[model samples]
Target: MTRRIVEILKKGQPEETITIQGWVRTKREQKGFAFIEVNDGSSMSGLQAILNADLPDYETILKNLNTGASVEVEGILAPSPGKGQRIELQASSVKVYGDADPNTYPLQKKRHSFEFLRTIAHLRSRTNTLGAVMRVRNACATAIHKFFQDKGFIWVHTPIITANDCEGAGELFTVTNLDLNNTPKKEDKSAIDFEQDFFGRRAYLTVSGQLQAEVMAMAFQNVYTFGPTFRAENSNTSRHLAEFWMVEPEMAFCDIVGDRDLAEEFLKYIFKYVLETCPEDMEFFNKRIDNSVLATADNIINNEFERISYTEAIDLLVKSNKKFEFPVEWGLDLQSEHERYLAEELFKKPVIVTDYPVGIKAFYMRLNDDNKTVAAMDVLAPKIGEIIGGSQREERLDVLETRMKDLDIPPEELWWYLDLRRYGTVPHAGFGLGFERVVQFMTGMANIRDVIPFPRAPLSAEF
Candidate 1:
């Protein structure tokens, strides 16, 4: 049976015969023998196979085993005399499934800039940085499921096509089947007739699953949604992506305090799990990608996060000596720079800022007794600010209706959402963590685009 390279490297004993099928990373030829590294994407480090000149068709196989060539090798595991790995493979037979031409293969045995790699996303996964990122990403996904499942949270599947704008940002991508060249317009011809569309209404790709997750939480007590979300924003920055994954968890009877507690525990759980499961990959990220990667993981796992009110956070930012580009005010939302200062420089740990001003937060957030702020909180990490944003949902029907009116949101469109409150509303709470952001944070990847395998951004969806 063919064994995965990770399994062979970790558990295969010396003299044990095994077969591995993978793509070659590098080939070094010597007078008597040749060494080639093979990786199957199971781990960061590949298995080194020693090919002796006496082996049948050694010259042809060695020539075929250029970087990026796929091969199957049957070999006996031997103690590696060289440093780094515990064992190496001594091959008896080698079969090349495909050969990557050294002249045309984009990924040669040299350093390539991330910007250049973005152009060849299909092949970038074979690179060390991207491979380590993917391993860490997989570990994070497993950890998330394990954490929620252990806590008895039901995994909920929410709709991808939604009619209501949950965030009310008005940056929705309309889903229509109508021919744009000869579109059906209203009698006045002022606007396109969405009634002729597929849903008979203006539908859009969902920007979030938080609203649907809330509905599930009301029934299941605790539920979470992990799925892809789309945005139509035209941002071309490294931080923004047109398509990304989200992790949103809602609790039926939870308040802001409970919400804060759960977010902190959730982050620490994922960090700890990744460190234990992918230590080698994490170490590579620390050494090659970012030196503070391990230290960030340690800080998250060891220290207690600081919690403060939004008013206090603003006061601190205002009093600090550092100059900020954005204004430090009570009503305005906190920018990334402000968030980083609080978490990285001031606290040197994760900081949960709560009780945001009402105007800046979404209408669903519960209004504080003061009526000027909402029961919302954001968890900011050292390197990346505002990793998680959540709020205690406003359960009062009267308050919700009034807030909707104040924001000019029509009541009929969200009648189903309003029904949730009219029937049997509870003090529910939840938060959203950008899945890519968490992976980027864990791996110390510079760009959000680098962490995800195929990134979707403005005018950049070739992969």
Candidate 2:
């Protein structure tokens, strides 16, 4: 029989019979009846079922039922006058499919640690916290697609397996299907024996889809990629994940300023959208995670982000008198501490730090007129440091060639990338927004692992 949700049941629905399926959350005893709290997968809040003493299995169901049990109940809707809740179910029959033994079920009525939840990744989703996170994640993803589609942007799918490294960092998870016991020896440790490998060439999972999206943008003018990006960095921090979703938007004729503007607007749109669509879940997070959740949302809608050059950000960091683990320097990459200080202490909000030193940035950043800094911007949020990083790509063929050479990147690896400049190239720019990081910020979740459903990290793919 088809089951109905408790939330959908209205008061005074006179004697309508239906079936309900869910895990039993609570059970209460009464003189003539028992109220069984059952929650379907729809939500955490369960519905009350008043089982009459006349039913043959009422006593058995009540005695056998535990906090978490898979069951189906055939019942009729009735008006509930006991509390603020409007309706209750009057059960006629109960069938137990699975019983959650209290001795084994990790999740009891009380709260559990986020770190502890990671051990039981398979069952974590059923918990109230993870369920709320996944729901908001769904809403945020939908908002991203809607925001781009409404603005006439085409969705581009970039390859997951790539021939070259996108980040230029040697961190890559190599792919091979050859026999490990009899693997061929390579001078450089690359999987060069194409005869045995699956792809027939030195290929690995893509670290980012930026370069391929650039190809699409050259023709489509404006495009975005929403896909998985694998990074093989072994740093065991809460922020780093082996595989994560990256939202990258590339525009054919846009410059650094254009990229910054779009990045700000795009983030604001998602933040606003989630707040509007997932109010109940966000409310749950706000009460459980952070008390300023509602106020933060309201302020985000009304506030304009602050922008400053990377030089200015460093200067602010120096003046703050904060003892940083990594000392601030002119040419050094902005550490997380520096980013947090600029966003929290100096600007006291979301801050855009642009024009980083060319030597410290990636190879694709457009070299500025001064030749010392690159046309780039990083959107640093108050609590979470650098959430977004992007820049106007080097469009000038000669300058790009020089930068690539200086960075020790071979021109042949980026054949099609250079071909864009050789043929029909316009000023293009884009940025990568860490999808898990956004969820963490919005939900006030402490770790990146807690936000994503199945987090991929080094040597830990057990889910």
TM-score each candidate.
Answer: 0.98, 0.93
lDDT at position 391, candidate 2:
93
lDDT of every predicted structure (CA atoms): 0.92, 0.85
- On the 0 to 100 scale, the lDDT of residue 269 in model 1 is 100
lDDT of 2 by residue, 68-158 (tens): 8888888787778789557777888889898888788887776889888999998888788998899889988999999999999999999
* Candidate 1 minimal-lDDT segment of 10 residues: 165-174
So what's the TM-score on candidate 2? 0.93
Query: Candidate 2: minimum summed lDDT over ten consecutive residues — where?
Result: 3-12
Which regions of candidate 2 are displaced past 4 Å? 1-18, 186-195
lDDT (Cα, 0-100) at 71 in candidate 2:
84
